[model samples]
Target: MQPIILENVIKNYLLDKIQVPALKGIDLKIDAGEFTVIAGPSGSGKTTILNLIGCVDTASAGKVVVGGKETGTLSEKQLTDLRLHTIGFIFQSFNLIPVLNVIDNVEFPLLLQNTLSPKERRERVLKFVDRVGLTQYAHHRPSELSGGQRQRVAIARALVTRPQIVLADEPTANLDSVTGQNIIDLMKEINQTEKTTFLFSTHDHSIMNQARRVIRLHDGKIQANA
Candidate 1:
């Protein structure tokens, strides 16, 4: 099954009691293990599409299927479970808990799911933490880490769950060019090695160049898929 599918999807936001269209008739599919980027200028619906596929938001019209399950059909609890179990999100802001140390942050998701023993969770968390090159900083809090290091912790946290699809929204936006490129390379390495399907929403040309496939969006519609 494909990792993501959006069929004639549309999303609207209520602004000042008026409906503002975010996505317009979006029909897209991302296969298993594909590293793809949705490139667009600001307000082009890139985030909207990502949210739909990530199950953070639903379509106002049409269907969104993630990891073979139609999001529209799932209950709120099921949707939460799907997001927790099937999707990983990397935000540009590096949404790590400032008070939590690196290892604790990475282990948070496992704790939430409560499916693994403490020993198993620690082992899994450490594996991903090392994969992201942050094992040395495992005991450090977010404030103690550099921008790039904090982002690395975020990446490890996202992967510790071993989700089928990882969604990154402008993941490199806040880093310097060199750090951003390094982060992209690190994610690419993980994508290749772990065969994790990655879908990124970014306007960064560097990320677009690194992506295996680029889907360009404009004015809330797909302009090109190449």
Candidate 2:
């Protein structure tokens, strides 16, 4: 089934009273459980696509439907609810709380959900922490972990929510080559085992090659979809 659909989508930003087009008449569909990459150079609209799919930004025209709901038609509260329950995000910077340890950071999303008891939350967090191979460093703060380990923690945090789609923007940009590949391997493994859809925006050639499907963007338009 298609979990994400963008039809003739357009996005524009105002810069110094000038309207800059980021995405122009783009059409795309992403099937569920696919490991996909949006590959492009800087200013190629990769992040803009991710932001639109993640429901964090609006399109100037056309439709963005996630998990069977049209994002533009939803109210603010409905949009927040959709984002909380259906989407997960990973960033290049490893956006983890410095004060919270690995496990706590993983459990943070569940706290916002408030659907699980403390004990249940702990169990879920521990499971993902182990899945991400961070069980040993569960008590360590983000500052104490290596760059790769910290990104692993971020992965666990993103997966702990059991989101249907995980949108990652330049997830490995900060890591060395070996570490970046390892991180990609981990994400690929999780995508296979958990059957979660992963859509990543990256300029990294290595990552683009690793993806099962690659969508190349250029100057706010799709140059290749393969």
Candidate 3:
């Protein structure tokens, strides 16, 4: 079954008095465990699509479905729960808590759900920290880590929940070319190994080349899906 599906999905934002349509109408289906990239120039709605898929925003019209659940109808609390349970997000800026150490930063999402005990969370956090080669820096805070290391922590955090899907919005934007490539490779390996569906929103051709399938957006609509 497809992990994600969108049928004429439309997302619009109210900027002051104007209605800025970020996604005009989109129809897309991403199969389970697929590595997909949504590519487009800035202001072309790529990030908007990612936000919708990640359940950060609701579609204005049509359907946005994830894990066989219809998205447009979910309540805010339900959507939040869905995001927590089914999806993981990697942001471009690497949004780690300033005060938390690396291990705690990675375990923070699980804490939100209050579903796992401290021992379980530690086990989960260590597993991913090792996966991302950050086990040695477990006690270091975000301030003590380099950009690449911080991004690793971000990736570990994204996967700590064992989410079925991961949505990355310009995840490599702040990294150097070499480090960005490393992050991309790490994501690819993890997706294949863990059977997690991966999707990225980026204009970087380097990233597009690495992705198996690419969807291009333009002016709030998908221009090409291939």
Candidate 4:
């Protein structure tokens, strides 16, 4: 089944009453459990596609369905709930809370969901943290860890809810080459074992190669699908 469906999607940004188009007439579908990479240079609408699929941005003129749910009409609060429960996000910058420890940061989404009690929250968070190989750093704040370690914590946080899809935007932009490769490997492993769909927006060819399917965007349109 299709995990993501975008039909005639269009996105525009308004700057001082001038409408600037970002994504124009996009139609795409991503299957479940596929490692899909949306690759392009800056301003190529790569991130826009990820945002649309992740339900952070609504299209100006089209339809977007995630996990078979039509998102064109969902209110902002409803979209937030959809994202919190069904979608996970990783970004170029590791967006962990500075005030919270590793485990606490991982548990934040669950708190938003209000599903698990404190003990269950702690248990689930630690399980993901350990899976991402950060069990020893659970008590440390974001300031206490290396860049790679922080990214691992972000991975754990993103996956803590057992989300159906993970939307990653330039996830390796801040890391060194080796560290970036390791991060991709870890995500790939999770995608393989957990059957989670990973959709990434990146300019990096290394990431594109790692993906099972690659969609290349240029000039606000998809130019290639491999």
Candidate 5:
């Protein structure tokens, strides 16, 4: 089954009592396990589309189905549940809690689910932290890590839940070119090995070149899908 689908999706934001359209009739489908990139310049609606698929925002019109469930029909609680269990997100900023150590930061999401005992949670968190090559830094705080290491922690945190789909918005923007490329490489390795679907937005040409599929947006519409 497709991990994400958007049919004739439209989105608008209100500014000074004026409706500003962001996405204009977008139609998209992201197959399970595909490494896809939504590429566009600023103000081209890349983040807007990701937000809709991630259930962070609602579409103004049309349908958005994630993991075979139509998001518009879900209640607030159901949406929260779906987000917690089915989707993972990586933001441009690391967004890690300053006080939390690497292991705690990666384990924070699991703590919310309350399904696993402390031991099970620790095992899962350690597995991902090791996968992201942060096993040695498990006890380090975010402030103690370099930019690449911090992003690795974020990646580990995102995947610890074992979600079917991961949505990232400019995840490499804050890192240096070498560090950013390394982050992308790590994500690609995880994508290949775990068969987890990844849909991330970025304007970086170097990053876009790594995607198996590239969907380019412009002026709130799709300009290319290759």
Candidate 6:
């Protein structure tokens, strides 16, 4: 099954008793193991699309099918379960718990699942942490790390569950050019080696250049998908 599919999806938000349309009939599909980007400026509905696919929001019209299931038909509990088990998210903010160290932060997601034993959880967390090249800073807190390093922690945390799909929202917007490229390369390597499907939303042309496929959006509509 495709990791993400949107068929004539529309999203509208109420603002001051008026409907503000965010997405205008967006039709897209992201195949499994594909490295793709949704590129657009602000207000072009990048985050809206991600939210729909991530099951954080429902579509106002049409369908949003994720991992072979239509999101509109899923119960709240089912959506929660799908997100926890099938999808990983890496935000631009690096949403790490300030109080948690590297190991604790990465282990946070696994704690939600009962399928893994404590020892197994630690092993998975350590495996992802080491995969992101943070083995030396496994004990460091978010405050002690650099922007790039903190993002690495976020990557490890997102991947610890071994999700089929990873959604990154402007992940490199907060880093320097060099550091941003490094982060992109790391994600690309993971996408290739682990065969993880990656869908990124960014306005960074540098990132667009790195994507195997780029879907450009403007004014809440698709401009290109190539």
Q: Please write out the lDDT profile of model 4 over residues 49-104, one tens digit for every residue.
A: 99899998889998999987889888998898899988999978999999999989
Candidate 6 error regions (>4 Å): none
Rate residue 213 of model 1 by lDDT.
97
lDDT of 1: 0.93
Segments of candidate 3 deviating more than 4 angstroms: none
Tens digits of lDDT, candidate 2, 94-201: 999999999999999899999999998999999999998988999999999999999999999889989999999999999999999999999999999999999998
Candidate 3: worst 10 consecutive residues by lDDT? 49-58
lDDT of all predictions: 0.93, 0.94, 0.91, 0.91, 0.95, 0.94
* Poorly placed runs, candidate 2 (over 4 Å): none
TM-score of each: 0.98, 0.98, 0.96, 0.97, 0.98, 0.98
- The digit string of per-residue lDDT tens for model 6 on 1-226 reads 7888999999999999999999999999899999999999899999999999999999999999998899999999999999999899999989999999999999998998668999999899989999999999999999999999999999988888989899999999999999989999999999999999999999889789999999999988999999
For every candidate in turn, the CA RMSD to the true structure comes to 0.8, 0.8, 1.2, 1.0, 0.8, 0.8
List candidate 1 stretches off by more than 4 Å: none
lDDT of 5 at 124: 96
Error of 1 at 101 (Å): 0.3
Q: Which residue segments of model 4 deviate by more than 4 Å?
A: none
Model 1 lDDT per residue over 13-65, tens place: 99999999999899998998999999999999998898888898999999999
Candidate 2 deviation (Cα RMSD)? 0.8
